[model samples]
Target: MELTPRLAGMVALLAFLPVVAFGVFRTWWAGAITLVNVVIIAVSLYLLMSPTESEAHAAHGDDVESAGDEAL
Candidate 1:
């Protein structure tokens, strides 16, 4: 089955929730470390998957330098 972004997110949440929950219940330090690790992983994944600013402009046929200069 193809893993769409939404599905992937759900899968990741499911996979982490149990371990994090267990850690949290066991001790403060474990909970903090696990939570921080999860946040870092999620952010890294997001940055890697998202398109760069130039790529987004190119995809929409917009001039990269002029993207923010349009009149409101």
Candidate 2:
């Protein structure tokens, strides 16, 4: 099975959430910062790993609908 960009982001977020929660429960402001950092990282990874419009179209060949879905 292929590991998509969305899944990569999800996995990163899952690991980061616990760290953020730990910091928050400890009453540290660092938790909020960690949350933001994690979000940024996840977004970066997703965008970087995801297929471009042209790439998606090329990969799918005649399947325009699938390419459009991937673009979303």
Candidate 3:
């Protein structure tokens, strides 16, 4: 399955909304669960939004391969 960046970000924010509301309402247990949910959402958002190291490596791998070829 695929999600657009904007949709993913919005989902992340929505996932945290209940926690924020629970905290404001002083519902401790619900707030705690919400906080956990928020953390999970945050990590998911970061992972989704950030570029993977593999992509960088792939981009630079050609240069490294060319250098090795020159040395041969």
10 residues in a row with least lDDT, candidate 3: 62-71
TM-score for each predicted model, relative to the true structure: 0.57, 0.64, 0.55
Residue 24 displacement (Å), model 1: 4.3
RMSD for each of the candidates: 5.6, 6.7, 4.5
The number of the candidate with the highest TM-score is 2
Instruction: Name model 1 segments beyond 4 Å from true.
Output: 1-10, 62-72
Q: Rank the candidates by lDDT, best first.
A: 2, 3, 1
List of clashing residue pairs for candidate 2: none
Model 1: pairs clashing at backbone N, Cα or C within 3 Å = none
Could you tell me how far off, in angstroms, the CA of residue 15 lies in candidate 1 after the best superposition? 4.0
Candidate 2 C-alpha lDDT tens digits along 1-72: 788998898887896768667786875777767777888988999999998988866766776677577678
Error of 2 at 18 (Å): 2.7
